[model samples]
Target: MALQIGAISQKGGVGKSSIARLIAREYAVAGWDVKIADLDIAQATSTNWKQRREQNGIQPEIAVEPFRTVTQALKHASVYDLVVFDGKPHSNRETLEIAQACNLVVLPTGLSLDDLMPSVLLAHELVEAKIDKAKIVFALCRVGDRDNEIDEAREYVRKAGYQILAGSIPEKTAYRRASDVGKAMTEISFLSLRQRAEEVAQSVIDRLSKEG
Candidate 1:
């Protein structure tokens, strides 16, 4: 069976899809069969990105497909090394089902009360539904230059009793531009930005590996 990793959040613009893409790309580059199950049928962000990636003739192709149901998506599990689910914006039956199915669930959020509060609430809901807390982790995304803000956000996560990633995705325009060309920072020409993106991707891999 393929290892399933899901990026989920109840709020929009939290960088859930971006994180999913980063992790999927990392595994793909490392020679693992990686596929992204784009569950947001309305947006289909990852599906579109995958199309763009192929059009550009990018190497190490990452397969992405849209599915109306989680069950339908799981049918391809036997063929891939990893299946990353880029979830929708709101909590629903699909969201809960993904939580139950994922080996690791990532909840991405910005460093602010508006972002943190709702995300924490959603995490709590997952636990209430009997999802393992160890498998659910919060990823700080689109962070800015304010060190204090990041520090405080980590404190909030700790106090709320949830796991958080050690690396974060900074708010960089490079990230947005890279996606335009069906590229992640790892493929970008800028060495510094590429390293930044790798930090978060590697951190996730390291953490999940230990789960074995």
Candidate 2:
């Protein structure tokens, strides 16, 4: 069976789809057959991004498909080495469902309490629903370049009693431009930006390794 990973969020614009594409690209580059289950039916962000990627003739050829339910997406698990579930923008009943189904549930958020509070709340909700807390992880996204702010945010998540990934997706126009052209975060033109994004991707990979 394929290892299922979920990129979930409490709201939009928090880099949920970005993380999903990042994981898909990373595994595909490593020669693993990967597919992104774009569960955001209303936006279809990842599905459209895949179209743009094909237009640009990107390598490795990551696959993406839209599905209305997590159950529907899981049916394709046997076809790929990995299945990334890109959940919708807001928290709902499906949030718990995704958390329950995925081997790892990643919640991406910004560095502010407005983002962190709700993310932590969502994690708590999953735990209350009898989901394993160990399976839930946090990733910082759209973060500013302030070391103090980043450290504080990390501390906040730790205080909330959950593990946060090592690397973060910084707020940069270059990243947005790369995504606009159907490129993953690690595909940015700027070497520094690409490396930083790779670090975030590697952190996810390492977390999955430990899960085994």
In angstroms, give how far residue 33 of model 2 lies from its true place: 0.4
lDDT of 1 by residue, 101-172 (tens): 999999999999999999899999999999999998989999998889999999999899998988778888
* Residue 45 displacement (Å), model 2: 0.2
Task: Give the Å shift of residue 74 in candidate 1.
Answer: 1.0
Residue 126 displacement (Å), model 2: 0.4
lDDT of each: 0.90, 0.92
Clashes of each: 0, 0
Cα error, candidate 2, residue 186 (Å): 0.4
Question: Which number leads on lDDT?
Answer: 2
C-alpha lDDT of residue 198 in model 2: 94
